[model samples]
Target: MPAIVGIAQVVSVGSSGVFHIGDVFTINPISTAKTFAGAGSFITGRGISVYNESSLTYTVDDEVMDQGINFNL
Candidate 1:
């Protein structure tokens, strides 16, 4: 099967409905995610009870991989 590409939207200002660089996201449950800025892109992050703000932190999820979403990089 060819790799599937996904896309997300910038939901809010303080917190992103879809996580991106310089965005904050707190995950309570196991949820799938993708990149917001670029379609079929990816980022790295962890499941945290409370997501602290970062300059360019990304939430690592498996909504669409091979784009750049990977942990322990």
Candidate 2:
């Protein structure tokens, strides 16, 4: 089962931590997590040093993980 949310809760990552949305912006390690907000839930993730999506011609401006990873669906 999955949960639903509205877009009204979509807030920017302002907290400081490894699992926080803001931390991923700078550290870019590579991982994946269950993204949620007033707009519901989403499986968010990003690539890492071992995996580069950019080189594959896939541009990911926003990533939920600090490294190369994906939230299992």
Candidate 3:
């Protein structure tokens, strides 16, 4: 058994990615991501003084994912 391809177009590919035309025995892909954010208000110093009052703001995130993929033929 065989395959015949006339035309093929590819846009983009990310990390740990693969592209094949003929055949493959085994394929494995892995990816990871991380993000951080901060929000606050401060008005104080050792040698400096602040006369104005400020509000406080806080933010938190608690979601994480660890995954993997494997393909074999």
Candidate 4:
């Protein structure tokens, strides 16, 4: 189906965020965050080391029907 939005307002959209008003087949959002805190707060002194690693995979279908949209005054 479809929808008619008379008025739409979006104040803010942060990282990995989305704001939609019309029809959508799929909306996917992925995010990853890493934080390191030490005695010096992410400050490494002599004879110190840090290591970080991450892996991610995502997939989505490309088959979707046409969704109509209309706006009214």
TM-score for each predicted model, relative to the true structure: 0.15, 0.15, 0.35, 0.39
The sequence of per-residue lDDT tens digits that candidate 2 reaches over residues 12-43 is: 64343233332232454244454333321233
Off by over 4 Å in 3: 30-73
lDDT of 4 by residue, 1-73 (tens): 8988898778899987778888898765555444434343456579876554543333343648433323211
Compute the lDDT of residue 50 as modeled in candidate 4: 50
If both were scored by lDDT, which would come out higher, candidate 1 or candidate 4? 4
Q: What is the model-wide C-alpha lDDT for candidate 1?
A: 0.44
Identify the runs in model 2 with alpha carbons over 4 angstroms from their true place.
Answer: 15-73
Candidate 1 per-residue C-alpha lDDT over 1-73 given as tens digits, one digit per residue, 9 for 90 to 100: 3454476566575432434444344534233454445322344567524343544445566655454323422
Each model's lDDT: 0.44, 0.40, 0.54, 0.58
Tens-digit per-residue lDDT, 23-59, candidate 3:
6666655644544432323434667644546544333
Question: 41, model 1: CA deviation in Å?
Answer: 36
What's the alpha carbon RMSD for model 2? 17.8
- The number of the candidate with the highest lDDT is 4
Error of 4 at 15 (Å): 1.0
Arranged by TM-score with the best first, the candidates are 4, 3, 2, 1
